[model samples]
Target: MKKKITLSILISEILNLISAPLAHAASLSDVYLPGKALGGSGATIGGFVTPLIQNLALLMTGLTFIILLLSGFKYITSHGNPKGTQQAKDMLTYSLVGLVLSIAAYWITKLAFVAAGLDFLF
Candidate 1:
């Protein structure tokens, strides 16, 4: 019972610290400035960068998916032709590379921001 009470007190304090920011946000702006959400507060630059990155990410991902789907269709339609099959495989492989690179870039950027002490995006 004593241990439980102590744990509860600690947890409550943590919750208060975390939520104290909520009591002060002027807007739900982090949705826009994910990468710029530093200073422990939201800013206009962050708000803009967040949505821009999100939209570009979505666009790139969608394009990659579309490429993969089209490549699958080509491979399927190639039937038994070795040449057509090879081309389709290359397309799929290139698309995979693009996807991997995009994801890596995102992580690298996050690490860079962290190393710069720019505050981790929320």
Candidate 2:
């Protein structure tokens, strides 16, 4: 009974903490408005999505690089263990593939944005 009550109280506190943020949540306009947060006064889908896509691409690239490094380390440390070496090789291959895909995706998005005359967004 005591444990249950404590768990319930903890859950309630968590709910309260989460609700505080929801109560003050920004509206869609506020969120989608380009440069509003940056003290600029323009709102375009390109403006909103370009940065998001770029940032996502950058993040993915960084993560892929880190994965590649870890996988290389694993490969070097495998010490003739076939399974470990294979796993590390797989990781390296997958990370390289992901990095390539992300770069291609970023370029495609950039081309689309340019074709749409939103090149200025970049």
Candidate 3:
């Protein structure tokens, strides 16, 4: 009972933290600079692309975590087989590499946008 209550409280706290940013999120009108036209690429494209890249990075990171879990499970169930153990090790390495690449992609997207003179994130 104690563990359940503690776990529930922790989960709720995490949810609140995750949702806090979204709760104070900018409205569509806020996406545009005061003098910029709504339909212009500066507002529309930047707003769309920044979030899309961020979300994609987040998704890839989550999938990498799932892959890590699968790799661990495979290792545990490998039953001393050399090939299976090697496969699990390879999976773990590949998943870590993928996670790193995903994070890099997110940063690269930001840099590319800034280099293109969009500077939308700021």
How far does residue 83 in candidate 1 sit from its true spot (Å)? 1.5
Error of 1 at 91 (Å): 0.6
| Candidate 1 residue-wise lDDT, 1-122, digit = tens | 99999999999999999978865663556555542445454355545565666676678899999999999999999997999999999999999999888878767766776676665445
* Superposed model 2: Cα runs more than 4 Å off: 1-40
RMSD vs true structure, all candidates:
12.6, 12.4, 17.5
Clashing pairs in 2: none
Q: Tell me how far the alpha carbon of residue 15 in candidate 3 is from the true structure, in angstroms, after superposition.
A: 55
Q: In model 2, how large is the Cα lDDT of residue 82?
A: 100
Q: Order the candidate numbers by lDDT, best to worst.
A: 2, 3, 1
| Global Cα lDDT for candidate 1 | 0.78
Clashes of each: 4, 0, 0
Decide which is better by lDDT, 1 or 3.
Answer: 3
**24-116 per-residue lDDT for model 2 (tens digits):** 675677665655654668578776797899789889988998999999999999998999999999999999999999999888888887887
Off by over 4 Å in 3: 1-42
Given candidate 2, what's the lDDT at residue 21?
A: 83
lDDT of 2: 0.85
